[model samples]
Target: MARMATHMITGAGSGIGAAVARRLHERGDELVLLARDAGRAKELAGAFPGARTLVGDLANPDRLSWAFSHQPLPDRIDSLVHSAGVVDLGPVGELTTRAWRGQLEVNLIAPAELTRLFLPQLRTARGHVVFVNSGAGLNAHAEWSAYAASKHGLKALADSLRAEEHGNGVRVTSVYPGRTASPMQAKVHSQEGKEYDASRWIDPESVATAILASIDLPRDAEVNDLTVRPGH
Candidate 1:
């Protein structure tokens, strides 16, 4: 039998994570879906035969470590997609330490820890690491201090990792996708008159397609940073 490509995807419960999981599943890749919610993880696993699920809050290092240690380790991880993130929008003065830390934990720290833990497997597979970052990382906006800071940190982390792994054959691609149609956005724009047309936002499937394209590129070709936005 042919060997299946192993993939670990964070935030696989919904949004771009789920879309990417589906895309890989269609290609016969074995998936490990990690999320905070067990029910959602099980639901996604049910949709894709042989796709395993890991339920844990990535913000907690103990939880993340325990899950991976107990679960079956993949022979090699062909792709590591960091789509998990949290957005807490508020004026700088109103942003509490707890809230800011929470955003950083999920958006930046967790992914970094995961990358550190799985670096060996990725190196063995000559795999690609994909960071689903945001345009906010490049451009700051009012009332988005925490979110912007976390994304900026993530972008820096990804860039630095790419440079460090230049000769190791592990490629890192930071994708800055603007305004996706996800529950996160709905929560962000829930206030009156700030309603966003989720239908008009970028499709998660399209982002998934782009991710797959990057991964499928020849080893000699690398797309370090890809920016995508809705065409509206």
Candidate 2:
């Protein structure tokens, strides 16, 4: 028997989000890919027939709410993956309020709001939620205060949601990936050091595989948190 499911993925235009979308599509899952760039979203949606695309800025609550309100909520959502994030590298003292707020809005607030909006559908399906957090959420580093703070908040939110949703048939997984080979990482390394080899970094495909493992686990068992790092 073919298993049918609906999945919504943010940041699905690239990186781990794109890999996860492809993997889920290959497994015969229906997908709704959301990204700020309509062109990129359209390109990805074309790769999977019947898959849908929604373009909106995560940091814009009105845009997000409008998009969700206009679209018919799925009867059930087997999975919701929050992968959209922004990283700003600067000394804490030099960071502006606007930068801090932007980071929080994109990394923390958007995911929380989106989850709340989709809670009913997730409840109906007993779905899983995945947060693509960073190792920065677990450990601190200089020159990344804003990004780290947002990720830490994200981690806390995911942990709290997991505890609250226990036995309610909703599983939450926080993925702390260390130095993934993504465009975001490239930007980070460009300012830091070329010593950070993309080849030595964790592959988005591998991270997506781990996510799939969590999603496919037996209903009675849940993988709460997973950390994926490249072999050093």
Candidate 2 collision pairs: none
- Estimate the overall C-alpha local distance difference test score of candidate 2: 0.87
TM-score per candidate: 0.94, 0.94
Estimate, for each residue in 101-214, the C-alpha lDDT of model 2 and write its tens digit.
Answer: 999999999999889888888988999999999999998799989999999999999999999887778999999999999988998987676656778888999999999999
Per-prediction RMSD in angstroms?
A: 1.6, 1.6
Q: What is the lDDT of residue 71 in candidate 1?
A: 68
Candidate 2 positional error at 70, Å: 1.8
- Candidate 1 has an lDDT of 0.87
TM-score (C-alpha) between model 2 and the true structure:
0.94
